[model samples]
Target: MGYGKRALGGVSALALLAWAGAVHAQDEVTQVEELTVTARRQTENLQDVPAAVSAFGANSLYEDQVETVGDLQSHVPNLSLHVGDASNAVVYIRGVGQIDSISFNDPGVGVYLDDVYMGRVQGSFLDVIDPQQIEVLRGPRGTLYGRNTIGGALKFTSARPTNEVEGYLDATLGNYDDRRFKAVLGGPIASDVLLGKVAFAASRRDGYTKNLLTGEDDGDKDTIAGRISLLFRPTSDFSAYLTLDASRNSPDASRTPHRETPIYSVNTGALRPVIADPDVVEATYNDLEKLKTRGAALTLQYDRGPFTFKSITAYREMEYRTHLDLDSSPDESFGIYDFEDQDQTSQELQVLYKGERLSAVAGLFYFKENDETFAGLVGPDFFVILPGPTYFPFPANTSGLRLAENTSAAAYAQLDYKLTDRASVTVGARYTYEEKWTDNRGEWFDPAVAPSAEDMERLFRTGAGFNVTGFEAEEDWSSFTPKVAFNYQLSDDVLTYVSASKGFKSGGFNGRNTAAAQSFDPETQWSYEAGLKTELAERRVRLNLAAFYQDYKNLQLSRFAADPATGNFVAVFDNAGRANMYGLETELTAVVTPKFRIEANGAYLHSEYDEYIDGGVDISDQRHLVNAPKWSGRLSASYDLDLGDAGELTFTGGVSYRSKTYLTVSSSEVLAQDGYALLDASVVWSQPGGPWSVVVSGRNLTDERYREHAFDLTDSPGVQLGYYGAPRTYSVNVRYRF
Candidate 1:
């Protein structure tokens, strides 16, 4: 809760909005429009695009109730979505990411759909019921987005199935036992030759953390989804579209709650009281996580009346499995059990051309991944005897295994030129190639002898049998990234920009707990950005501001140790020696009088560590940059009256804040969370020609206890473990349209 007190509270909220100079007349009475984006590959207008993007159409995520993609970290701007435990999640932007949860590893933000390419990270936690837009391409998009992008890229677009018939349906009920459902259905099966759509969604929840040693209930969840599409238009030069999507996630019974331990008794000065074990239903450290995803896509279009051609083909498959309980200490002698499984495949090809000022794009990408894991060390086998006697034993066999394979290919291009009438310029490039291979098979068993030929030749000699060992290697890499941007339009709703970019992420093999075949390099970035997009006053306000600086190289770091010769406990993956990040982002919107509206967003980051090395000591890089958060903000408001004959009545509210982060970036003994502000309110009542609608929401209206990641243990400094956030809840929704 201290980064100089959230950078002096964001500089006193920008000096109270510059002493309220009517805040530019609240963007000149809210006329703000124009915000189309494709991030430099056509379709401009996000202040003409020079990078540092952020968009969320689909009616502003259904008026900001944003149901997934982890709710866009409460209105993005420096984004974050840590959420570990139960299938883990780590998505930091600006300060990079990945803390370890191996699955052909690679994520520092990169997720696409509609241009397909979702290579794990649980496929970016789906469930957004249907989208027509969602783009968040900030910094380093590696020239037209081809590799990892350091910390950027999240795109999704879906909504195409028209030739008449429309669709809608939504339902929800909440407060812990929550339930949700969604539906969509589209038109024509053969009116001018085919067009169709289908969509479905389901959700169920029942836990909200409360396993104080098993008093039961601890964040449970379940989900299901489906999608289908088809479209074919013949004549006037070609058109085609096909899509299929699927999802399932069943396994999440989140837990990690324990605190209460105090005792003092030296024969007389006594004080002791400790109890916790409400019939332990589950949580000797719990585990559960199962996931599934499927995909297929095809899009083709051609126009020939002055050039217009496009093609997109995609195939994706993802499967995930998790069972973990890496000790949150419910004391089953401090448990440990873990598992992982993954599969991936991808291919992309693109082409685009638009005239009337020049626009061009080109692409080819292919990816493949096969990951398999069976991490080991699952509890109980005990022995302990004391008091003038000694005996300590516990060993029941096989404790390690990891296998991996990864492959990649890429080529990309972009161009945009419109040197007059508001000037514009963009150029891009991308070329990538990657390969990785790993195999580590080491197992030990001796509950009292049975295997020995020198322990089976030290478990097939690759790193020759554990205990402070290392290496089982194979690696390959190649790279090229380039970008440039410039835009200017000093009128017609102003815009100005500047940019520079380069980003990439690819490098693998850690095979859990290191046996030292190390190999990690390919974490690069070089970004510099500047921006301003405005539409003030008479345009109903809309403003965007951006500033960035990045220069991070080979920064991957992941460490956790305890291997005084295989007492087993090692998780090492390293490559960190340079870092530097800077940021400032702002967004504002107003429609201040069309029945009232308002929006605000903010971010301010500043990271460090220009070189660090630990345990062979070097450490001095100012620390604290793991989950980066220096300041974050969000605000929202809405109102629409006029209920004559119950026609309309709407109200909405929002607030969000973040500051205080570091779940481990080589420690600062700081997990001081304590900067929380969340409030969401809603109410809607409508009726104006009947399609039906109703809404009632109340999320986290001051039921904040906040703690999303915190940890410490060096023999337990009073044992701290965390992950809690999600309290006040309430919901009721209904919608319909045929």
Candidate 2:
């Protein structure tokens, strides 16, 4: 049978299990644990919520060994997460998402931690350090949480301090010289009045790629993450919590990722290297990258009879450094260095009310951010005039600087009311106002000699002298987005619902814009969906299905722009053409036998551009949306065994499959990625009534070769560039709890 048939049969078999269980195991029937979630900013049963949300508790996270957010892609359907380097963490959902790598352009999706919003994409590559839960809500959420909820929202809730003393230590070792350790401690500082927790995690790994030129590793990683949280409750109705977190990474790597040896050069039309094996690459530069991030948040809540009130105040700071060899050659024709810094602050006030037949939440949010950039591009020792072909004995360096400030204010409210005992309706609205202003400046300097540190310093004099001084631009926008939904309870174990919602993203100045036109309008999307959730056979089986159609306009797209000074391409954001997306999704989970459990999910998508224009050229009819996979799905199974005195043993395995996907907004036909599949497995052994355990994990058992990011460099001499997926990896871990 084909894969698609197998998928449908598996789901059908799960439904049939309902009747089978009704006859075989009527005496020992036990349902799967019902999960609780804060999807609507209020605690509620996951199955009772009238939305498409995927929630993973701490136990699930441990079962999958999900340390980084990127690992979620293996299990989540209709989701794509890309990490080109340590700096770019782009996320896409349901054929809609963001690929903005810089700090200026905002993301299409919103990311929140413990009710506090994160505004930058550079720092969104989160490492989970004892988070209690992670929730991924699909579809528009603008009315629930403003700003960049056009695609979806991700919520990561940290674990809180408990009255009882608790702690855990976990250590791991893997191939590629990988080493890691994590520890968590929580206890009561003063009985019931005060509590606190501390968590720390660190990891290091050798580079997957070897630098043939330098005979050293190119992408080695050394990182550390730490967090501290404290909770205070001086009164029965009043409580407060404070959290502090920081992370740092230093790698002597390059923007020149592992590149395939040239086969048939598009630029020269000549055979260069016959590379039958994709595992190896030849590179010449030993580049450098450094990053640091720090943040703090405070939350207070008070119960006031029929109403509850809460406040959140947050501050964040980030610093990033980069050095790259643009040519990726030993000749050093061109090289670049970048230094960037950012700081942000946010404040929010919330009020929630719960009545016998009505529930509501109202919130006011304010945000402010400041960002600065200083960068330089160094040219070769000898250059030539274009077309005329006259070689000049001069070296020129290009420098640029930009500083931008942003502010946003918003008010949102959502209410759910019961129209009948089995029927209900929900309505929500939000109004957001934002403003951004930026100052841009740059210059070119030449020393008329062989390029050297001294020669370049003498030409530009100092970094301060390269400032462009008198260019400034500002943009302001206001938008109102709304949501409406109707839900009905058909029976005690079945629900059906339909929703209509609008999403919006703010306008901003393109930090890399080299012209007078430096800003683009905000993007908007409207989505309509219908879904059903059912519990069959005394809760032994659960199935969820959803269908949606979405319309997007004034889409925000990231592309490369020619930099006149450096003769290279710089990232620029623009308003691309509108697009349409429609898809079907289904998920099933079942407890088939006493020792076996199975879960599966699949998504089929059809997305295309309705209108597209770039540089006065219309290409809407020929391109597909970026990052939109034609089809994707996952299937996983687990089995448990009881071994008397030897304790218990468990085995788990999963397989994920994805169809063809595009890599760029323009859908450049040459850079498309074909279909691929991955296999993963794990085994665990534990002691009875236990405090200690061991686990062995393996990923990509078949060693599938794929590309995470692929691009045909139109700006740099028609070269094809791509970042290969990680090869097969293995790890063994030990854990102790007290």
Candidate 3:
């Protein structure tokens, strides 16, 4: 996306903070609730954290109808998430992130469950599974949580097993034949010594798109996930937790009407759109995806007075496969069959101590992984051997495979010292070392296309026709990240802090790509931030504001291009250039009356390439990073009432807005989306503190049509690829608790 100099929308986005306070004053109020989060590696009140953080409480999640981590974009400012294909996704925080879904490159945004790192973008579409809380920490996080975290981090905490018998059953039925069933059942296996919990979640829906040629439903949904957790506490000082999880997701896929998002044909110099409206598609192959994953984690903690020692060990594996018609046409001109297999294991040991004047946490971490990928493409049918002669037909079927092994280790320590009762200083650093070994091979052959030796003699001698190259290579990268901060209490009700941190993402061998671009160098970023957290109006209102500036270097860039001879797909990677981003964010929560509450979040961002050179072309200042919007915001309100004898009723509503955003750094005029708005609301009815309840919720209530991804089909210029956001969806959920 080209970086156009447009208005930043700073004034209007920030105005939400003031507007919310004024609107709520005309009504009654409720008390602002305290939210605790693990943003700092230790449990602490959200209002006490010095960094920029947005925490979702169990109640907030239900009231706001937040389903998955991706849904948080509507409620959290400065954070963005979207997916193009099943395995193609990106997460951006403050204009910094990764868009390459290649198996070789790890995500810039770190995903963690109970402190266990999830390093891949594939299979990261996590659904809330009896979760107690979710926290999103904005900005670079390296001192405490190392790994590929230059954008930020996402933390999810599931409810642990409890001795008391408790769980819930949830069911939902929606339009488009959507049906969902979920259950959480658990209790004490042995009263005080052991507790266990098991959960099952499943959802299925009919496709919304009608296939014009095949008369089949496209874009359906089929997903199921289950988890089992156990907690053991034989002694007061020793506690342990073991968890096993597995999930399978197969969501139907569909493309938007070509007319809605047209692409230009270089040959004709005309715009072409395949079809329009009702999501009608003519495809020669299935554009569906299937993903499966399994994981196990064991956590052990030992505490002695003011000192605690902890160990976390985890193993995870994922398998993903997909088939798509690259041309988006009914012709068998081009298509792909992609398969990916990945497995990883990690271990961490840490020690924590709290003294009268100092507090510290030190840890060591180890991570290892084995990943493999295979990409198949139907090459163009007509091709002439070099020297340009009459077109000769060849098999034209091409495929490539990359098998890799990765090892990573890190050691880190953080310490906090008190200068006074109201002032403190903190320092931390982590050193990480990583290495990757990869074996690559390629094949271009088809007995069906062209099986003549007369066509192979000259070409094969020149290393051109049906060429196959195999090689193995290794690369290693290391970095030291550090952070420092100072906090001061301006008053009993307010705290202000300033912090700076450095973060980096390790290099790796690019999977499913050309050997020449097989590896890249590590990328690094430095960020400085200042923030204030306050409790105004006698603790009835809460407001937190922060500003940050970041500088990035050696940003890895990935894109798709066609092989000159066969017109086969190739994923190319390069340590392109640098970028600078700065932004301001604010969050507000106020209780206007005993029965009413209002919350607001907003951000204004400015991002641009400081030095970006693409294909020996200086594109700096011309292209903007993907997912970075000049302004974004969300406002929400809730009201609760007690029906003395009948039941309790609650009403909630929210509206979110995002400014225009480019789909990619090489965004064309057609690859950008204008600012848009989304409306959501929910009504809850239940007996006061009862075990049964019903919720009626609606999302995208306005039914706005927007593009989720606007991809340039480099291999096919006549047609562009686009993914559309879901339209208005409503669901009636009934729940029962034990």
In the range 397-497, model 3's lDDT, one tens digit per residue, is: 56667788989999999998889989989999999999988887766655354232222221332445366866788989999999999999889879999
Clash count, predicted structure 3: 10
- What's the CA RMSD of model 3 in angstroms? 5.7
Task: List, residue by residue over 463-549, the lDDT tens digit for candidate 1.
Answer: 443343335777888889888888898897778888787888888766664445656778888888889877665656566788888
| lDDT, model 3 | 0.75
After TM-score superposition, the amount by which residue 38's alpha carbon in candidate 1 deviates from its true location, in angstroms, is 20
User: lDDT per prediction?
Assistant: 0.67, 0.75, 0.75
Measured over all alpha carbons after superposition, the RMSD of each candidate to the real structure, in angstroms, is 24.1, 4.2, 5.7
Q: Give per-residue CA lDDT, model 2, range 324-390, as digits (tens).
A: 5544444443456666789999999999998888999999999999998766566553233222222
Q: How well does candidate 2 match the true structure, expressed as C-alpha RMSD? A: 4.2
Q: Which stretches of candidate 3 lie over 4 Å from their true place?
A: 1-29, 251-272, 379-395, 447-465, 515-517, 562-570, 715-718
Q: How many residue pairs clash in each candidate?
A: 12, 1, 10
**For model 3, which pairs clash?**
1-664, 1-665, 1-666, 1-667, 28-592, 28-593, 29-592, 29-593, 29-594, 30-593
**TM-score, prediction 3:** 0.90
